[model samples]
Target chain A: MIEVRHLVKKYGNHTAVSDLSFDIDGGQVYGFLGPNGAGKSTTMNIITGCLAATSGEVRIGGYDIFEQPEKAKKLVGYLPEHPPLYLDMTAEEYLKFVAEAKGVKRSDMKRQIEYVIEVTRLQEMYKRQTKFLSKGYRQRVGVAQALLGEPELIILDEPTVGLDPRQIIEIRDLIKQLGKTHTVVLSSHILSEIRSVCTSAIIIAKGKMIANDTLENLENIYSGDSYVTLRVKASEIEIRRALAPMDAVMGVECTQLQDGVTEAKIDIDSDFRDKVPEQLFYAFASIDRPILHLAEEHATLEDVFLELTSQADISEESADDTEAKDGETV
Target chain B: MTAIFKRELSSYFKGFTGYVYIAFVLFFIGTYSATLNVRGTYPSFEYAIGNMSFIYIIVIPILTMRVFADEKRQKTDQLLYALPVSMGQVVVGKMLAVAVVMVVPAIVSCIYPPILGKFGSVNYASAYGSIIAFFFMGVALASIGVFLSTLTDSQAMSAGMCFLVLLVNYFQTTLVGFLPTSALASFLAITVVILILAVIVWYMTKNLLAAAIFAVVIGGANFIYYSVRPVKYGGLFPDIIGKLSMFSRFDTFIESAFDLTAILYYLTVTALFMFFTVQSLEKRRWS
Candidate 1:
C-alpha cells in the first residue's frame, strides 16, 4: 500500500530522517516502533505528502507524492501527532468539513460519517465543541477525521501518547478492527501498546531502520543467547573457577554475600544454551557445592527491543533516546 | 476548491468575525453616505466611498489575519497539506472567500447612490463606477494581506504586518513627495530599497551568493539606466510609487472617469499576490 525509498529529511544541518526505506503491505497492523526522535513521524509526514523528502521518493499505491500529490494523498488517511482539530467547531461540524474536503460523494457521505462516528464511538461528543472535550475524545475526533474517506491506508503518529489506559485500549481495539479492512500503521514508543495489536513491527533508531520483521522472527533471532542464574553455597571465586573450564559458558559473573553464599549469572552461547543448565548442575557438584537454584531465562520481546535499539553501532541520537526510554520503562 | 471555499466562508460567520466585519464596514459607509449624500445634500456618493476608503486598513487585515496564520498555530495546516487538493486551489479558494466577504459592503454602497436619487439628480454612472473601483482596491490589498498571513503563525503579527503594509499605501502619495527629486538622490534611494530586497532574499533562501548576485544585477541595471538618462531620474521614484499605489488609482475613479487601466492594475496586483500566496503555501513542503 505504501513504499518509501531512500527518504531523507534535513532541517538545516541536522538530519531528521536519513535514507529510511520501508514497505507497508495491505491488510495488516504494522507497528512503527521507535523511541522519541526516531524519524517515524517525519517518514509518515513525507509519505502522506504533508512534508517533502530531501532526496528520495514516496509512492502511495502507485502515485508519486511529489509529482501527483492529489492522487497519492487520496490513497492514505493521516492523523498527525496533534489531533489537528478546529477547537472552535463542534466535533460534528469538524467531521462534516473533513468529509467535504476529502471529496466524499454526497450519497455516501452520511453513511461513511455514521460508520466512523459509530466505530470511534464519538456519538455523545459529536455535538460538543472539541475544545470542551478531553484529550482522549479529541484524539477520537482526529481518528474519525482520518477515517472519513475510507482510504486504503491509515497512518497515525503516536496516536495513544497521552490517553488513559482504558482509552488506549479502546483506540487499540478500534485500530485492530480497522486492520480487518484497511491497512493500518500506528507509531508508539510503548512496547506493550505495539505488542497489543501488531503482529509485526518496523523498528527504527537514529533515523535508520534497525529491525523489520514479525514479532516471532524478531524475538527468535535474539533467542539464541540465554542467561543462567545460580544461587549456590560457594565463594564467588570458587563459583567462577568451577564454571571456567566449560567451553559453552561465554562468561561468568558472581557476587558473594554473608559468609559465602554466592549468586552467579552465566552467559551461555547459542549452541549449548539448552543443555548448559544441566551441565552447570554437575560443574558445581564437582566442586562439592550442592546447587541451591538454577534457572535459564530466554530473551523476551522487551529484551530484544532494548538490546536492538541500544545497539552501539546506531550512533549518537539513539543513545540519548534509548536512555530516556529505558529510564521510563525500568 | 468549492469545498474549501464553502468552509472558509462559513467559518467567518460562525464567530463574531463575519458579523463584526460586515457591521464594521457598513458602519463607516453608512456614516460617510449620510453625511455626504443625505445630510450634506451632495448628489455624488463617490466622495462618500472615497472618504471612507481608509476602512480597508482595518478591514483587509481582519478578513485575512486568520487565513493561514490561525491554521498554522492550530496545526490544522497539516490537514490542508495532507488533503487531496493542490496548493493553488487552496489559495484561490481562500482568496475567493475573502473577496465575497468584501462584496457585502460594496453591494451596500451601491444602494446609497440610488437612494439619494429621490432627493435630487444623481450621476449613477460615476457613483456605481466608484463602488466597483472601491471593491477591487479592497481585493488587491486583501491579496497582500493573505500573503502576509502565510508568513507567520501568529495572527497578531500577521495582522500587524498587514496593517503596516496598507498603512504605507494609505499615505503613499505623501511619502513619495517626501523623497528628494535630485537624480543622484533617486538613484541612491532606489538602490537602498534594492539592498533591503537583497537582505529579504538572503533571509528566505539562506544563500548569500544568490542574493549578492541578484543585488548586483538589478542594482547595476538601475544605475546604468540612470547614467544613460539622467533627466529621467528626477522624480522617477515618486512617479513609480504613485503608479503602483493601489489607493491612488481610486483617486482617478473619484474624478468620475472609469480608468480601465486602473481596473487592470488592480487585477494584476490581485493576481500577483495570489500567486505569491500559493508559492508561500507550497514553500512549507520543502522546509
Candidate 2:
C-alpha cells in the first residue's frame, strides 16, 4: 500500500533521513522502531507528503506523492508527532474542518465527524475547546482528525509519546483495531509497545533502516539459546557433573543456592524439554538428587529489540540536542 | 481550498487577530475620516485612503504573520503538507481568507461614502473606484506579507520582516525621489540591481555558474544600452522606481483619473507576490 524508495531528507549539511527504502503491505500494523531522530518521523513525514524528501520517491496506493499529491494523500491519514491542532477550537469544530478538508461529502461530513469522535472517544469533550483538554485528550483529538475520511493508510508519528501508561495502552489497542482494517504504520521508541501491537517491525538507526521483518521472524533470528533453568538439591559441582555426561546438553553453569539447592542454567542444542525431566529423574535418582525448579525461560520481544537496535551503532545525539534546544527556548 | 479558507476565516474570528485587524482598519478610517473627510470637508474619501494607506504597514503584518509562519512553528504545516491539497491551493486559499478580512472593513467603509452622499454630493464614481483600488492594494500588500511569512517559521520574525518590506514599499515614492536621475547613475544602479539579483538567484538555486552568467548577460546588455543611448538612461531610474511603487500608482486613481496602468500594476503586484509565495512553499520540499 506504501512504497518509499531511496529517500533522503537533509536540512542544510545535516542529513535527517538517509537513503531509506521500505514497502508496507495492507492490513497489518507495522512498527517503525527507532531511537529518537532515527529518521522515523522524517520517513513518516515524507511518506505522508507532510515534509518533502531531499531526494527520493514515495508512492501511495499507486500514486506518486509529489506528482499526484492530492490523489495519493487521499489514501493517507497522518498524525504528526506534535499532533497539529488548533487549540482554541472545540474538538467537534476541528474534526468538521478536517472532514471537509479530506473531501468528505457534505451529506456524510456530520456523520463522519461523529463517527471519528466516537472512535477516538472524544464525544464527551466534543464541545470543549481543545485548549482545555488534557494532553491525552488532545492526542485523542489528534487521532480523531487522522481517522477522518477513513483513509486506507494511517501513519502516526510517536502517537503515544507523552501519554500516561493507561493512555498508551488505550492508543495501542486503538492502533491494533485500526490495523484490522487499514495499513497502520506507527513509530515509537518503546520496544514493548511495538512488540505487543505491531505484526512487522522496522528498526532504524541514524536515518538508516537496520532491520525490517515480521515480529516472529525477527524473534526467531535472534532466538538462539534455548536455555532451561534447573534447581536441584545438590551441590554446584555435583549438579554440573550430573549434566556433564548428558549429550543433549550443550553447556552447563551451576551456582550454589542459599538453601543448599544448586541452580543450573543448562544450554541445550535444541528443545530437549520433554525427555530432560525423565532423564533428569533417572540421572538424579542415581545420584539421589531432588529437582527443585526446572523451567525454560524463552527470550521475549524486548530481547529482540535490544539485540537489533544495539547491533546498529548509530549516534542519537542530534535528537537530544534538538530537544535540549527546544526545551531551553520553551 | 475551501477547507483551508474556512478554517482560516474561522481562526480570524476565533482569535482577536481578525477582530484586531478590523479594529485597526476602522481606527485608521475613523481618524482619517474625521481629519480629511469630515472636518476638512474633502469630497474624495479616496484622498483619505491614499493618506491612510500606511495602515497596511502595521495591519498586513498582523493578518499575515500567523498565516504560514505560525503553522510552521507549531508544525501544523505538516498537517497542511500531508493533506490532500496542493501548496498552491493552500496559499491561494489563505490569501483569499486574509483578503476577506481586509475587504470586510473596506465594505463597511463603503457604506460610509453613500451615507456621506446623502448629505453632500460624493463623487460616487471616483470614490468607489479608489475604494476598489484600495481593496486591491490591500490584497497586493497582503500577498507580499504571505510571501514574506513563508520565508521564516518565527511569527515575530515574519512580522518584523514583513513590516520592514512594507516600510520600504511605503516610502517607495519618497525613496525613489532621492535616487540620482543621471544616465551614468541609473546605469550604475542597474548593475547593482543585477548583482543583487544574481546573489539572490545563487542563494535560491546554489548554481554559481548560472547566476554568474545571468549577472554578466544582464550587466553587459545594460552597459551596451547605456553606451548606445546615454540620454535614454536619464530620468530612467526615477521612472522605473516610480512605476514600481504600488503607492504611486494608487495616487493616480485616488486623484480621480481611472488609471488603468495603476490597476494593472496592482494586479501585477498581486500576481508577482502570489507567484513568489507559491515558490517559497515549493522550495520547502526541496530544501
Deviation of model 2 at B185, angstroms? 1.2
Model 2, A148-244: lDDT tens per residue?
A: 9989999988999989999998998888888888899999998888888999998888888878899888876887766788889999878777877
Compare the candidates by lDDT and give the number of the best one. Answer: 1
Which candidate gets the maximum TM-score versus the true structure?
2
lDDT of 1 by residue, A253-315 (tens): 888766678888888886787788778888887779988888887787788888888882456
Residue lDDT tens for model 1, B1-287: 88889889988998878788889999999998889888898888888889999988987898899999999999999999999988899998999999999899889777887789999998899999999999999999999999999999999999999999999998998898887888888888899999999999997788999999999999999989988998988887788887888888899888888998999999999999999898888888888
Q: Best by DockQ, which number?
A: 1
After best superposition, candidate 1 residue A227: deviation in angstroms?
Answer: 6.6
Which lDDT values do the candidates have, in the order given?
0.89, 0.86
Supply the DockQ value of model 1: 0.65
| Residue A60, candidate 1: alpha-carbon lDDT | 90
DockQ (Cα-based) per candidate?
A: 0.65, 0.61
> How far in Å is the alpha carbon of A41 misplaced in model 1?
1.5
lDDT of 2 by residue, B1-287 (tens): 99899999999999899999999998888789778888898767788888998888998998999888888887788788888888888888898899999998888888778867766778888888888888898999888889989999999999999899888887888888888889889888888999999999998889999999999999899999999999999989878877787777788877787787777788888889888888888788676
Model 2, CA-based lDDT: 0.86
**Structural similarity to truth (TM-score) of each candidate:** 0.86, 0.91
